[model samples]
Target: MSQPKDVEADLVFWRRLESQRMEVDFTKMAPEKCMAAMIEPDDVRTVHIQDIRGKETQYNLKLNGFQYVWHDMPELDGVAEQSHVENVVVPKTEALRELSLIIWSRTGATRTVTFAHRVRCLSEDEAMLANNRAPAHSVHSDFTPAGALKNLESVVPDVAEREELLKRRILAINVWRPLKTVQRDPLAVCDWATLNWQEDRVTNRMVLPHGWHELGKYAFRESQGWYYLSEQQPQEALIFTQFDSESEQADEGGMTLPHTAFVVPGTETLPARESIEIKMFAFL
Candidate 1:
C-alpha cells in the first residue's frame, strides 16, 4: 500500500529576513532598496527533492498550480534535436503562438480569453539579457497582484476590453519547456495550495525597463510541496501559474507556483540546460 518515491535533491529558497527588507533586481537596473543583495549559495538549504515523473498528468493546474505534459513541437523538433553550427533556425513568434494555443486545449483551460501573443525563441549562445542568463536558482513567481494588474493594462489595448476582462477572472501563466533534451538544471515547482501565503509569501519590488512592479518571492515552509520532471525533452512542458485575479478566493483556480531551476546531482558533466518560457494571460 506504499507509493514509489521519485528524484530527490537539494533545492534553494529565499531566507526569511524579517529584521530588514531584502530586495534584488537580477538585471541590477532597478533603483536599490535597502539590503539590495542577490541570492547566493550560502542563502540556501539542501532540501532533498524527490522526482515526480509519475505525477505528470495527475497534477492539476486548478489544484496543484502546475501540470506537466508532452507538448511536442514536431515542426521544430528536428531543429532542436540536432547540433547546428552554421545556421540555427529558431522557431518563429507565430510558431510559438500556435504552440501555446495547442497547449491551452491540452491543459484544459476553461478560461474564455482569446490569447493574443508574440513569442520569441532565445538562447544564451546568442542574445543574453537579464531574462536570458544562466538558469536562476532562487524560488520565485514572476509577478505580484499589482504587477499582474499592470500587465493587464499594458497587454489589453482597448480600455473597454480591459475593463470587461477585469470583471472576469484573469491569470498570467508561464509555459516552460526545454528546446532540447535537458541535461541538467531541471526546474522544481511548488504546489500553490500548500504554501503559507499569509505568513511566508515574500514580496519584492522588481524593476524593469517598462517600470517597477511587485514580484512574489517566498520564505521556506515545510508544508510547501515541490515537484519536477526529470531529463525533460523537447516534447514536454511545465505549465504553471504566475498570477491570479482571485488570488484570495478559494476553489476558484490555482494561484501561484514558486519555481526554481535546481541542479541535478551527478549531472555537471553533461550539457547545460537550454529552455524557453512563454508568458500568456487568460480571461474567464
Candidate 2:
C-alpha cells in the first residue's frame, strides 16, 4: 500500500532559552504561566500498510516507534453513557488491565503489567469534563524519569519489592485509541529515532488539583520527524512508550516517545475528537 501523503498541520513546540512557567490547574481552570506555542503548517507524515496480516507491522513495536493494533472491546461502548466515577470510570479501568496484558505479550517483555486506574479523554470543548479526563494539546511526554520512579513507588506500595523491581527494567507505555472514527484533532507522534534528548527535550512543571509534578516536553527542531495514522477507527489502538529504565537504550532509540494533538488544516465542520488513553508500566 502507498503511504499516506504528508500534510501540513499546526504543532505546539516549546521555545528554548525562554524562561516560562508551565503550570496548569484543572480544578480552578486557571493556567498561571504556560509556555506552549503553536508552529503552524508543519508536515506530518504517515506509513500505510495495505494489510496487517502476518507482517512485521503486526508485532514490531520498537522499530515503528508506535504500533497500531486491532483491539475491540464492547465494554468500552459504555464509556459515554454516564459521567459518574463509579458508573463509567471504574469499568474502563478493568478494560485497561486486559489491554495492558496484551501489550505485554506483544513486546515479548517477561514482566507483570500494572495499569494506572485513571484514564484520559480529549475533546474539542474545553468546558466538557467527564471523569477527570481532558485533552492535552501540547507536545509532551506524560512523565519524567524522576516522576516515573515516584509513580512506580506509589503504585507498587511495598518498599522492598519496589526496590527490587527498580533494579530490573521498567517501561511506561500509553495505550490510546479513539472512541469513534477519528477525523479531527488526531494525535501525532515524533519518531523515536529522530529525538535528541539533550537538544530537543525540556522539563515542564504541571500543577494539578491534587499536587504539582514535573514532566518532559519537546522543543521544535528542523530534524524532528512526525507521523500519524489517518482516520483511525475505534477498534485499533496506538501503543507507544513514554519511559524505559534501560539507560543504554537512550543512545540506541529509547522507547519514550513525544507526541501531541494538532488541527488538520482545511477540514471543515469536523466532529469533536473523543479518545481514551490509559497508562501502564511493565516490570522486566
Query: How does each model score on TM-score?
Result: 0.74, 0.73
Off by over 4 Å in 1: 1-8, 19-36, 40-42, 78-129, 247-254
Question: What digit string (tens of lDDT, one per residue) describes model 1 on residues 147-196?
Answer: 66776676787999888787777777777777677767878888888877
Clashing pairs in 1: 6-51, 7-50, 7-51, 8-49, 8-50, 9-49
RMSD of each: 6.0, 5.6
Predict model 2's lDDT versus the native: 0.62
Q: Cα deviation of 27 in candidate 1 (Å)?
A: 12
* Residue-level lDDT tens digits of model 2 in 1-284: 33453567667676663532344455455432232222221223322212232342543345545677676766667666546434554455445544644654544445555445334444444443224455566687877776677677767889998888887878787778887887777777777677777766765655567665667777777777677777778777777777777735473223467888777776535767777776777765
Instruction: Tell me the spans in candidate 2 whose CA falls farther than 4 Å from its real position.
Output: 1-5, 18-60, 81-122, 125-134, 207-211, 251-255
Residue 163 local lDDT, model 1: 82
